[model samples]
Target: MNFKFHHIGIVVNSIEQYEKQMLPNKKVREVIDKIQNSKLALYENFNESYIELIEPLNENSTSFNSLKKFGNHLNHLCYKVGPFSELENFMRDRKWIKVFGPVPAALFENQKVVFYLNRNSQLIEFIISE
Candidate 1:
């Protein structure tokens, strides 16, 4: 499948408290302040991968629903890819069942994204930057 590692999505009940727990440094705090809402706090590790700490707007939100089931856990591993159909077919052939969309993601510059559940029940997100 045509894919590029983007970020790891983490569902958290509260973004502020979680950030403090994960990243409790002045420099990290400075970077966190730059991003409004600051839901997705960037903590660069060995690799340049990002950890998106997503908080639910309300009980009805997708993140909240996921939080209820999973409880502050790794929701998905995202990948930025192209020619959407090619990857879609690849997943289908491998029997990686589609879970959620090819929906328009306002956060990702209104790009199209989708989700699939792998054999281990680990959710994988595919985002296409068109």
Candidate 2:
């Protein structure tokens, strides 16, 4: 149940626009993730920490409602976790409910990612450690 801070996900109306306006000179990796129904732009710092910008692909996208409600804001905190099998026990012990995933993520080279909502209703993402 080891957790390492990975990235802060931000929901944006447009990845291209956000990158242009906010991260003009930063190196970013962009991906169109069909599985997640969102476009993503990842900016990784020297320490391996990242800032993930997410844009919904359509109305059915998972981030659509969040974007509609919050309008371009911090979405979730992601962590890299190992011994992937222990996730269930860890979530149960902490009373965190799985909301989505354990699905392959295009942004992480298809590594599995899971979403959870803690008691406080804070969304969190857990990506299987490489």
Q: Candidate 2 vs. truth: CA RMSD?
A: 1.6
Model 2's TM-score against the true structure:
0.92
**Candidate 1: 10-residue stretch with minimal lDDT:** 27-36
The residue ranges of model 2 lying beyond 4 angstroms of the native Cα positions read 23-25
TM-score of every candidate relative to the true structure: 0.77, 0.92
User: Per-residue lDDT tens digits of candidate 1, residues 1-130?
Assistant: 5667888878888877787887542322122211223244444544555677777766656566778887999888999888678887888788998987887665565578888999888899888765
Task: State in Å the error of residue 81, model 2.
Answer: 0.3
Question: How well is each residue in 1-130 modelled by candidate 2, as lDDT tens digits?
Answer: 6899999999999987887776434556789899879999888654778899999999989999999999999999999998567987899899999999889999888999999999999999999864
Q: Name model 1 segments beyond 4 Å from true.
A: 24-46
Per-model C-alpha lDDT, please?
Answer: 0.70, 0.88
lDDT of 1: 0.70
Model 2 weakest lDDT span, ten residues long: 19-28
Per-structure clash totals for the candidates? 0, 0
